[model samples]
Structures are given as C-alpha cells and as structure tokens.
Target chain A: MSPRPETAAGPAQGRPRVKRFARAEHRVHRATAALMAVCVATAACLYLPFLAQLVGRRALMVTLHEWSGILLPVPLLLGLASRALRADLTRLNRFGPHDRRWLRSVLRRRGGRPAGKFNAGQKLYAAWLAGAVLVMTGTGLLMWFTHLAPLVWRTGATFVHDWLALSLLIVIGGHIWMAYRDPESRAGLRTGSVDAAWARREHPLWTPEDGKGGRGEEE
Target chain B: MTKDENPARPAGHDDDRRGTPVGRRVVLGMLAAGAAGVAAAPYLQRAYDETLGAAAQNDPTGLSGLLPAGGGFRYYSVTGSVPDKDEHSYRLTVDGLVRHRASYRLADLRALPQTRLVRDVQCVTGWRVPHTAFEGVRLATLLDAAGVRPEAKAVRFTCFDGAYSESLTLEQARRHDVLIALRMQDRPLGHDHGGPVRLYVAPMYFYKSAKWLSGITVTDHVQPGYWEQLGYDVDAWVGRSNGRDDVPTT
Candidate 1:
C-alpha cells in the first residue's frame, strides 16, 4: 500500500497546483489596475451632474462613467483570479496591531509614526473601495434592467450611483497623488512586486499568511 | 479633470506596505466562479426558454425595430413571471380618449393578420445585440381594433409587471417596426425576460422594448416611457441619445 503523491496534500496546505504571484501576473495587474483607475475616476467626474444638475459635461461624464464601470470588473476579476494579482491583493489585505496605532496617530495628526502592514488610512481606503465597487455594480445592474426594478428604486440608485462615483474620484485622486509623489509606492504596483527594503520599512508586519489578508489588513 | 486627480490608481495609505506572495486557494476559488458562469449557460438558456417565447428571431428585438423607422416589426413575451401564454389570462386593452374602447384576448390577436421583422437590438447603455427576429401583429392592427379618437395623439404602454411604463407619439405608435410581439427568437414567450407579451421596437434601445407588456392606451401626446422618465431617452434611436456616441448599427 503506497501513499499517493497528489492525495498527500492536507487541508492546511491549500491548493498547490494553483499559483501565487508571478512576473506575468504583475504585468497583468499593472495593466488592469490602470484600467480600473480610468473607469472609477470617470465615474467621479459624473458626480457634479448628479449632485448639482445635469449640465453639458454631465452626459459625457455619465457615459464615460458607465462604460468605465462596465470595463472595470474585467480587470478586477482578471486580477483576482490572476496568480499575480491574487498574491498582490493578498499581501495588500494583510493586517497587524501597528496598523491600529497608525489609525490612532492619524486621528491625532501625529506624524511619522511607524506602522505595521497597511496603516489605518490604507485599510479604510481599501474597505471603501471594495464597498463602493459592489454598490456601483448593483446599482448599475438596476440601471441596466429597467423593468427589473421600480421607478423609485432606479431614481434612488441613480442618485447614489452618481454621488458615490464623485466621492470615489475625490478619494482616488488623493491616493494617486500620494502614490506618484512617493516613487517607492508607485513602483510596487507598476512593476508587480515592490522593493524588499520598501516592504520592511513601511510594512513591518508584512507576512504571507494566506487568508490573513495581511497586506491591506482586513480592508 | 485635474492632473493630480487620478481615480484609477491603487488607493494605498499615506504610506506603503509590501504584499506577501499570494496563496493558491484564492486563485482556484476565482477560477471556479468563472467556470460556473460558463457551465450555467445551457441550463440558463433552457430556463430562459421555459419562461418566455422567442423575440421573433433567435436574436434581439432591436433588429426588427431597425426597419427604416416606418417598417413593420414584432415582439414576444419571454419570461416565467409573465401573466399567461394563452388567450385565457391575456388582456389587451385600449384606454384614454378612444371612441371604440375594447379589451381583446390572445386568440383575438392571433386572429388578426400578423407581420414579421428582422432588426438589430441596441441598448441605450451602449451594447448592441444584433440580428433579432420578431413576429407580431402590426400596431396599426391593434390601433384599429382599439379605435382612435381625433383628439388622440399619444399612446402609453403598461406591462403586467406594473413597474415599467412607456409612451409614444401617435406617429411613433403607427410605425411598422413597433409590434405587439407574440414570439421572440422564434419561441413562445418566456417569463424572466418579460414573456406572454412584450413590445418590440426595432432600431431603438431595448428599454424601449418593454417586457411583461399588457396594456396599450392611445393618448393626447407623447409621454416618456419607464426609462426615459429616468434619464433615458424616450425615442432611443441608436447612438442618438442616452449620452453615448456609439455608432448606429443597422
């Protein structure tokens, strides 16, 4: 009687035939991430039309916004399923106690506090992004299927859809500036993996705990 | 519009963190979800089939509407939630200012001469599902049965769903591609996609194609349909409105 090699895997080990991040994975994420940015921002641009009044640019804003959203899930799904993107997101989602302190200090405007894994700002941003994306998807579908929902629901959905898009743009704008301003951070997603020293310096709590979602710390 | 305002970038914290290598399980789970959507297509089609009749052709209703704005067309019910397939439960009525008011059964509609059409089904949302086949009684036939008063210059569409409504000008209502669809994709109407009876307007966006269609009332003037009242175009000529610049598909 022999122990089969394929059957040898345990519940704890997880699926090995599946892969983690690879170089090509990084390339895919870079491209997809760029695309995702375009759509979410475009959605934000439409915010003014909804919040105030539907003006000249409002129509263009809305069309671009929707098209962008429709296209966004493509990258997200691709990235999530992608070995590289999964690895990237997994690492980003991780968390630790230092992240807690980061939140506390930021609240106090206390500068230069060393944080573990993703800081509070990063976690909040990630969580907001995840929630907004889901909301957008749901409302977009409602907008898509006119007969599926009532008029009131569609109106409300459209209202929230537009405002959330605006808020996303504002927040995402700040994020991009911070990234581009800081070369090290921007380099990470652009090239797939980040520099080793960059990781340890900022993400002291960084670890590949699989499902711990440590990188972004539960965001 | 600002250069610094790039919404597409990854929203990291004020500081940065390094991502650990990913686990294999996450990848497998995502793959499974993808495979499921693909595998479910056939069963979904069957289920879709069981619910609604075809859209006149194997394609969308838009193809039929593409008939030169003055052509003939058809639409059908295609959902499980529709009222009923036969004449027993169907109700085709004409309300508003009309000299000859009446309600007809499904058998009554079949008794009338039917027309057929082929067109491209376009969505105001920017997607165009092409080459739809539709079969239905000409709206003119229905309008004649309902009888129009001189004051009437509009028509309103009400569906069994009661959630959606649409309006057309007297002229628009008289167009040929506009049909009270009895069949779609050449099958009996289904319920999920608005079966038993749905309106098919070729060349216009699908929203103009109301599902669960139940009522047709001739009125005084143009009134916006369900989606049109909610930031959608009532006319919905492909690539003309709904904020997109998509090229019109014939």
Candidate 2:
C-alpha cells in the first residue's frame, strides 16, 4: 500500500477519494441544519419571555416564530427533487446485521464493526428527527388555525408541541456533540467524500469498488 | 427467549447478547421521562394560568390584549382617557339618514326591555373571554323605536373614547344578538368596562361592539372602525373574519 489518508480513525496519510454522501445529501443536511438553528433560536426568543411573563403574545416575534416554523419543511420538500437525496433516503431506511454490531460497539465504547453510509444510530436519529418535524408541523397548524380542530385537539397539540420542542433541542445538542468529536466526519459532511482507505477502515463491510457501491451483494 | 434455544445462533455472535443493556437504558429513560412529566404537570397548569390569566381589573400593562382570558375582559380606550357618563348626564344619539333622530338618557335607555345574553367575547388578536353576560336594550329595539329609514343601509357607531369608530350593515345591526349593553357580568358597567352604556354585538369580535359607545348613525355605507382603519375587517364576525377561524365565542 502506498499510504493512507489521515482520518479520525487513525493517522496514516494518502487514500483514494471515494464519495460518501452525494452532493444533494450534503446540501439537504446543511440547509436543514441552518434552517433548524434559526427556527430554534426564534422559538427560544418568543417562548422564554412568555414563560417568564415578561411579555404577552407579541405580534412581531410571534409572527416570526409562526412563519419560520411553517416554512421549515419547505427545504426538506425542495431537497427531495434531487434523485441522489431520494436514493440516500432509501439507503437510510434499511438496517442490516452490520448495524446491530455497530450499535453494540458504540455501547461497548469500541469500534468493533464498521458501518455503511449510515450507522444504526444515525439512521435512528434521522427517523426520529423526521417524525419530530411532522409532529411539530401538525401541532403548529392546529394552534394557528384554532377553530379548525376541536378543543381537545387544540389543547393536546399545545402540550405535545411544547414538549417535543424540548426533546428536539436535546437531540440537536447530541448531534453537535458527535460532530464536534469527529473532525473527519465533519470534513466528509462538508466535501461529500472520504478517503477510500478511511472509508474501508471506518465502513469495512460496504466500501464501494471504483465509486460503484457494492450495496446489495455485500448485504 | 434464551440465547441457547436457537440452534442457528453463531457461537461467538454478540449482536443479541448486547441488546439487554441498551433495551434496559431505553426502558429506564422512558420511565424517567414519564416521572418528570407527571411531576411537572401541576406546575405546567399553574404556570399557564398565571402567565395567561384573565385580564386584570385595570390592566395597566395592556398584556391582556394578546392573551386568552377564559371568563375575563379587557379595558382599552383609544382616547387614552375614558369619558364618563352618569345617569343624569349620559346620552346616546341616533341620527343621520334616520327618519327619527333620537337621544336617550341613561335611565331612559334602562327603562326599555333589557335583553340579557351570554356570549364569548373574542378579540381579533386571539384572546377570548367566554360566556360573558351583557344585559341591555337591543340595537334593533332602539332602531325600531327610532324608526330606521328605508334608505338607510348601514349603522355607524362612534364611541365616547372619541378616537374609535365602528359600522355594520343595517341587517347586521338588527341581529338578535346585538345589544346596547348597560351592564356586564351582572354588574352595572364600570367606567373601565365602558360603563353607563356600550354596544355589544354578540356574534362579532369584541371590537365591533365598541366600548364607550355614544353614537349610532344610520348611513348609506359602512365606515370602518378605528382598528378597521388600521387593517381590521369591517365585518368582524366571530369565527368568520380577521383571516382566522377561531372557535365562535357565542
């Protein structure tokens, strides 16, 4: 072997550049993250004061919060127009035997098994975040169009909307923590590619051959 | 399911072996969350009530305008100061395009048949005070008493607050739910609550039922109220206008 690229898994230098996430996958992730940051910030600004009884339903702040929340899913829907993202979604849906081994390694604080494009934890988190976004939108509409739902749904929506907001904050915090700890992972997210040696070492079971993914055969 | 019961299990496979700890963590997390939710329930209810309680008797902060008030009410005066009218000095004038222009004293209006109605008072800003009772003479009763002219198509309202004004179609003005309210919540209207007399359009948002009501002018067309001039709808029907379908308070 000539040399291996310096990856978070280890320090050897020069490996082939292999695409990990497609351009569309990177764009979707980046845009969604940026939008969610603003949404969360606006929510914090609007909600904290009301909780503290510092202000009532302020029109300007409330309008910003409402519109930002309503528009959050736009990027996700627009992102789906990319076939690469659609393919990524299909890949993210399936959990294989390697995923179970990866989870076990995570629990044991050791990298026992290498993962494919997405590990089990990542897949679970994506699924959870998608569900959360749906819940937020549904509840938000109920609150906005108050008379559109019955009293029970209105009240229930308020309760769920608030609690889920807290949970989402926690989930996002975890994501940031994981990204901060792994610079190579962050780099791959930025460039949409990883060193081939790093890919083999980090995701041993699913390395693509000359950029053609060996997905079904390996699984 | 014991690990040994399945003959296909690989000798050193750890996949199923490690699931126990992870599953235990998930169960424990759920239990903790449930406990926290239960413990926080009462505080949530109390906090909600305090933060969004009924409008204060004399809300100086004006926060009430933007909050729901269950069985509460708010005091808003466009003129900054409310003009007071007692039994001896109060007058409500019905004029312009009317065959019979009329004025009545507080006691004189009180002498008319009083109609009591309990309706939800909805503000355009999204606050609602439910089941609020208003007792007074009906607008139609007064219009009938004054004799509305056939050519009159709208009824314009002017308030003692001076700056605020509202109007409704003659037909809307004649709705059974509309009242020239003399009392609210079983008490004579206090000045803060637009006492002496106020217009109460039961099926419309509260602003259309102008506070400190002073004038009911019959006109050829509708004149937008103070808020309407600032972009509120001229026809502020409950659960209908203001670009929202809030549950009808009535």
> Which is the leading candidate under TM-score?
2
lDDT by residue (tens digit), candidate 2, B1-250: 1222345855533232222333233434544554454345446645766655534434777554333232254444444345578887788999988778899999889899999998778876455776789999999998998888888899999987667789999999999999999999999988767778889998888888887889989998888878787677888877788665778876
Q: iRMS values in order, in angstroms?
A: 16.1, 11.1
For all candidates in order, the CA lDDT equals 0.58, 0.69
**Candidate 1 residues B1-250, lDDT tens each?**
0013235555643222333212223333333433342344345434533444244234454453322111223222222223344558778787787778878777777778877787777655333455777788888777877678999888899887555788878887788888888877788656544667778877577777787778888878888875576567777777676644445644
TM-score of 1: 0.44
| Highest lDDT scorer | 2
Write the residue-wise lDDT of candidate 2 on A1-219 in tens digits: 113334543323333566666566666677777778777876765554333133323344456677778877777688777765655565455566777888898899986875766667876777677767766777788778866866555555665677778888899899999887766667566666666666777766554434632111210
DockQ of each two-chain model: 0.04, 0.05
For model 1 chain B, the run of ten residues with the poorest summed lDDT: B66-75
**TM (chain A) per model:** 0.66, 0.81
